[model samples]
Target: MPMTSHRAALQAWLEAMPFRREAVAHLMAAQEAVYLVGGSVRDALLGRHGYDLDVVTEGSAMALGRRLADALRGAFFVMDREHDVARVVVRQGEAHYHVDLAGLRAKEIEGDLRARDFTINAMAVPLRPGLGELLDPTGGLDDLRRRVLRAAYEGAFRDDPVRIIRGVRMAGAFGLHWQPETEALALATVEALRGVSPERLRDELFNILALPSAASALEHPVGQRTLPLILLLDPLDLEGALEPVRLLEQALAGAVWVGAPYGEALEGYLRQTLSVGRERRQLLKLAALHLGCGAAAPQKAEETARHLRLSRREGIHLRLALQALDDPLWRAESEPEPLSIYRYYRQVGEAGVSGALLALWAWPKGSTGERMARRAHRIIAAWFTQKGTLVEPAPLLSGQEIVRKFGLTPGPQIGALLEALREAQAAGQVHDRAEAWHYLKRLIEKGLS
Candidate 1:
């Protein structure tokens, strides 16, 4: 089905759905007016299916929530008081739908719309019979049609400075431009973001950077400055410090799902690039800096890994990519040895290596770069498939093993030895129990002598 037809069908289905209809009936029967508001209405108009539904009422949100919970047998969580919002979680098959019920303090719908953050989100569709119409008192539909973001009021930013980041996120997500007034509001409110909590600011920053068009949005001078400053609480006055961030954003844009590896990489990159005192920025920077470099240079790769604060596992990936890029032998082969490929699996762990390979393949490149990346990918795949499949190799020596074998007491040395052995095993030096014993024996003997 076409996008438009699908959306229209969904809208019709939602309107007729038992849950929505029941909620509408309950609200009206209780003498309270309700409207299907926010993202659901906005997305339906934009020809998209909204996963979450937000309902606003003119009366008691708690009372409405309990009533709806009883009707639908859904779980009700009265999570907030200041906003008078209650959350209902309803399950359908594997997907869970969230319905938010909010009580309005305003005397009229127009006043309620004016209290919202952005014009596009300020529109509401009434759920009652005579009021079952779009009460877009703020011209949100026009803003949506124009693909522009506008603040609902002058005080909107003052109410919540975090909305500025949200505006950037929306602009990136929908490919919309901010209105001139909205842009000015965002710029002026940039300083007010200092008042927001660090954790909230961190979350908003991650959301913005994780978007596909995040790169394009970050390329905007104002956005670049604003985002970094929000994170660091200090200014980054560089002309183009956001260039790498843009590259990362664009590279990750096509991903169907952004998982742990992506999050780890992004977190590391932001910490280093932003110079924020949050935690382990240097480590994230190291991982990100070596992101696109294929098996190029071993010494440089190791150094880069050390600089970026990568764990032993991450360092192995950097080493493998560097080695592959530098390998004239791999380039010479119509098919590289299974051993060489097994080494790749052994070194980086399969998931990390595979993720690195995909990153290399997706890295912005010309014709030659593309061909090399494709060839490298094929070689890596073939090697893994031909081999008996990579399994996470168990440590040859544990802390207990170290204590038992070496007659060592519990101490930092035991921990340090265990770590060394694990790194050696990952690097493929010690293949078995005997090798591990001998390696430890030799280290002990050398140090004692």
Candidate 2:
């Protein structure tokens, strides 16, 4: 792994991955000074498999992005029209990845690398074979060799404080030691984070939480480097919530499983994306982070969710997980009955999946630990296996039925009753149409009373 060979190795790594050659080949056709830059270069050097390809070109980056999309059979988006940033996204079956192409920030590759955040990310290789040698103007190669993380310049964090979060994440992700000055600089710039957009802060936080070391790094025994960011969470009780995250990350990373039987379901539960494509695992951590926050967890979850600009689905998932951290199963020394489990799921809906993990991991493993494990296992199994029967029974009473039968207007009451009936059905009190009608009638009577 000599410095020269890094470029050659990256060229081969590009060929092996799905999108690289097609993107580089198309960009090479442009006669622009196309170079593989940023993490696309760093990750390849470390032999880490990465789906993202970062490219900078002398020509219009957006135009090249559209052409690369056409060449790679992907979709192109003008991610930042004013900033001359564009993205090409490609889907590979169940998973999707992207390439971001941007016009050079500076006049040349050397200047562009100098303006980047970190030395390791500041290295680049020409996209066209034999066009040039590996470019390392800022000692990125030396930093990588020393396994040390360093800011590209003194003002890197000041320029974009979100890089501080990214710096911590990369440190955890690659196990790179912080050059003391870089760490000091990043810490000094924490207040500047307030000026950063909520979206940028959020995406970087997500990236940080996605790391296997996220929980420990954020709450490290020595000191939590991310405490400044956590304090921004205010009353959410986000601090000291890493236990659930620790467990969740372990399962997601295949370091542990919820048990062999429900392994697939548990993985899917953690991996599934919300409507806005944000990860459930990250939101789960946020929900449980406030477990110590008690009554404030739900409100804090909602407030923080709004600040993060999470999708409606994502917000509900986070808020609900916090809302219902305590459950019958977690309380009971024995596994709760199906009806209890059904009620729990009914209360939180889809957040039940996340809440279950939070509860399971946060459950202590002493004395009755085995029972709680069994309880968690059964509850999670029901979510994937028996949800149709015991958890979310097919609704017998539709909203249309309520409006027609009850002579009621299409309003809040109808919606409330319809949702309640699903839980009632789970209670096994309403098995058939006749029983469902009687159950609704009793509910209406009870409401009027």
Candidate 3:
């Protein structure tokens, strides 16, 4: 799509609301400068389809947002009560949108544009007599045309250093090289990111890593400053450190990530949703990056998770993936013992899939690396196809049943024997209940002898 005026998109977006566009139209009637501002305008100009709406007006943003929320049958959230900021969250089929409403920080639209972090985001289109009239106080349209990113003002990063993270992510996402001034400002103020709140830093970092071209985003020079401080990795070029991440991406896309074959077995697993709209792919990529931490990789992963406030589920995934790098069970062989596959899933649970993929990426460095990657492929295959034994094998005899049959009580002995029985079952030694009992009896007799 060619870069075009966003007036049609803005119109269609407003019209799509369930309660019609009356709520916003009413607000526009009451407010002198009700406008679609910031990134929404920028994205629309770039021919990007986005549902999130950023609106700024002179009137009470809270009241307007509430009305809009009710109109769209969406949930309303007060972002900043003091600042008269509110958000409306609504979903249209699979697409979700957060329509953020805020009263103008500056008195005029021009001042608001001048105050944003980047030029492209500073533009606004009025929801008035003529939406065609583009507000280009900072020349966002021109910058978009040039495919360049520029800071809106010299103090853009100083006023809120969080913009440093935002700038790099946006720059990479848009594939726009930073203007020299923007790059200098980002480099000079990179250290200021340490002072930013953890939540702010985490959200931005996750957003950065979540980008489709995350490696490209991390390659931004800004990450050289932010990553070591935030991610706790040794000072290294993010491109090289993230090679595993790129490999994982290829594997997820069903490509040759060190010769692993992609097939029906991986389709759904690869498309797993970590939480809400967040994909497991993002955390998987993060795990691959931390794999470069060498001996202290797990510790560094822990610190990074804590620093970023990663969810417990996400933390577990990273630990499992990195751990798989050195695990004995991570063998890639054509026909391996079922015990190894069973033990792997048992040890790592759901993260075994993540671990397998990481192992595929990490174990391709030397002669052993090739062997391990092929083993990782077999593990993935078992996970998808041989799940009856390897992925989720049912126990032949429950611990309660074992206790009843053996005239024993529920204790550690029963638990240990049950695990032994399960392992035997995984080894294909015990199938029926009689076979399971016979195996246990032999173990008991051997132990006594």
TM-score of each: 0.66, 0.84, 0.89
Please report, in order, the local distance difference test score of every candidate based on alpha carbons. 0.61, 0.76, 0.75
Residue 106 of model 2, lDDT score: 85
Off by over 4 Å in 2: 1-4, 90-97, 129-131, 220-231, 234-239, 251-261, 395-449
Task: Return the top candidate by TM-score.
Answer: 3
Output the number of the lDDT-best candidate: 2
Residue 437 lDDT in model 3? 85
* Candidate 2, residue 315: lDDT: 79
**What lDDT does candidate 2 reach at residue 205?**
78
TM-score of 1: 0.66
Report the lDDT tens digits of candidate 3 across residue range 1-449: 25445567656655666432654565566445688788877776676665577889878888888777776678999999998999988877886778788998888878978999999999887876546477888888888889888999999999999898888789778888889888899899888877888878877877887777777777768765777766755675233676777666655654553343547546567567766555677777777777767766766776778777887777777787677656665444344688877887888777787887887675457977777767777788787777776567677888888777777777888888988887887888888889988988898778721
- RMSD of every candidate to native, in Å, equals 8.6, 4.0, 3.2
Deviating ranges (above 4 Å) for candidate 1: 1-10, 13-31, 237-239, 253-393, 397-424, 427-429, 435-449
Q: Is candidate 1 or candidate 2 better by TM-score?
A: 2
lDDT of 1 by residue, 29-128 (tens): 6667787777777876776664577888888888888888777678999978888989888776776777898888488778888899999899887766
RMSD of model 3 against the true structure: 3.2
User: Global CA lDDT of candidate 1, please?
Assistant: 0.61
